[model samples]
Target: MKINILIPVRALHDGKRRLSPALSATERRALTGWFFTRTVAVARSVLPASDIILVSAAPDLLAYGQEAGLHIVAEAHPGDLNTALRLGAAAARRKGADATLCLSCDLPFLERNDLEAMIATARPGAVTIAPDRSGIGTNAMLTAPIGAIPFLYGQNSFTAHSAAAKAAGLIQTTLRRRGFACDIDLPADLDSIGFMKNDRHIIAAE
Candidate 1:
């Protein structure tokens, strides 16, 4: 099957606002850069043969996507994450994608094997959700047929997505892995990821 990896990123300034307590505005922006860079890097590493589409409201990310050789889909100026993701999925479907893997940008530790394994084990008519460290938030989602179900990402999103998948008559499977579960959200999350002290990509706010 032709798999398309869709990565959606908001503006650097607006991305990861929840991390403000642990990171300043400047730090947040830098973190956003690191996040996107690593995300694309991981995606490329894992799905090198698959089509990779990056959807973003930030024009700056367009160049980065281009440099990474990823297909860039500029999102509408003001739209939520789900909308941008939908746009990307539509584009992927139009491009003849048989499946779409929607991923979050904050996962820097994600590895190629995780993705390859997921795709290799995926079943049709099922939605694969990789939950975050807390096991409540979804970090990665695999939706077959692209428009099978609405992507709802927020607090307690795992349950919500599971319900949505069931409603769409798609089996919901939860897969957990360190690379897929650890995302930089709170200060504690960063610490857990071991990027709090010194990550080359990070720029302190003050």
Candidate 2:
């Protein structure tokens, strides 16, 4: 079975707005870049470069993705995240993928093993949903047959995705693993990253 990883990224300039209380605009973008790079790195460890798709409305981000050897797909709908994800799903399907693991770019602690375990749970008619540490948000989701379920990706998406999968009669698996539970978001979330709160090393690539 061909499995692909799709990550949809917003423009870095406006990303991580919730952390603005503690970090500057430059810091936020740097953090965004760090996470984006980290996500791609973990994905590359499990799959070939061609199978990891990066979708973004920002041309510079797309260009950076292409430079990293990821399959770049331009998000046609600028501000609509679900539509952008759908476009990534379509791109994965076009590349002959049997399943698409939709990944969020802000997973600071994600490792290669996390991605490998997620792939192992993927089936032809089933989906795997991984919720955030808060259990109120979705961190990672793997949908079979490329886009078997509609992308409901905002505001309590963990429940929304499960409902969508149940409504479609597809088998659902909920994975609550430590590696998949954390994602960088609010100012408080930075404290758990295992380093100094203002450590600028994450954005050293800049």
Candidate 3:
């Protein structure tokens, strides 16, 4: 099946504000760049860059995505996360995608295998979700037929997505892997891992 990996990104300057308590503004921005770049790297390892789309309203991020040879979908300005993701899904559909995996960009510990597992979980009428460590947030999800259910991403989004998929009559699967569970949103999340960055990958050391 033709698949696309759509990653929604916020403006780097305003991306990791919740971590301000432990990281300076500059550090937070750098961290945001690091997280997004690493997430894309992992995706590239799973699929060709041509099939990966970076969805954002940020011009800077779009430029970066273009430089990385990834398809760029311009999200509506002042849009919410769900809206941007929906737009990305639509774009993927227009490109003839049979399934699209919506992935969050802050997954610091994410690996190529985590992405592979999510893709493997997808079926003709199935939705697979990888919940965050708290099991309240959706870190990664692959949906067959793109818009079978609304994009529900926010507080307690895992529950929202579960109900939506069930209502849509799609078989649901939840993947619980350490790589998918670890996203660097708060200071505590950042403190849980060690990051070593090089030209290619962000190696996370426990």
Highest lDDT scorer: 2
TM-score of 3: 0.92
* Tens digit per residue, CA lDDT, model 2, 10-58: 9989799999987778778888988888888899999999999999989
- Model 1 lDDT tens row, 46-159: 776238999987888888888778888997685887888889999899989888999888887788888886787566787899999888999999888778888898879999
Clashes of each: 0, 0, 0
Write one digit per residue (lDDT tens) for candidate 3, span 1-206.
Answer: 88899998999888878988877776777778878888889999999998998999899999989999999998768488898888888889998999999988887678988888888887888899999999999998999988988898988999999999999999999999998888888777756776423323432221
Candidate 1: segments with Cα more than 4 A from true spot: 201-206
Q: In angstroms, how far off is 46's CA in candidate 1?
A: 2.2
Give all TM-scores, in the order shown.
0.91, 0.94, 0.92
Ranking by TM-score: 2, 3, 1
In model 2, the Cα lDDT at residue 78 comes to 76
The local distance difference test score of model 2 is 0.87
Query: After superposition, which runs of candidate 3 have C-alpha atoms over 4 Å from their true positions?
Result: 194-206
Question: What lDDT does each candidate get?
Answer: 0.83, 0.87, 0.86
| Superior candidate under TM-score, 1 versus 3 | 3
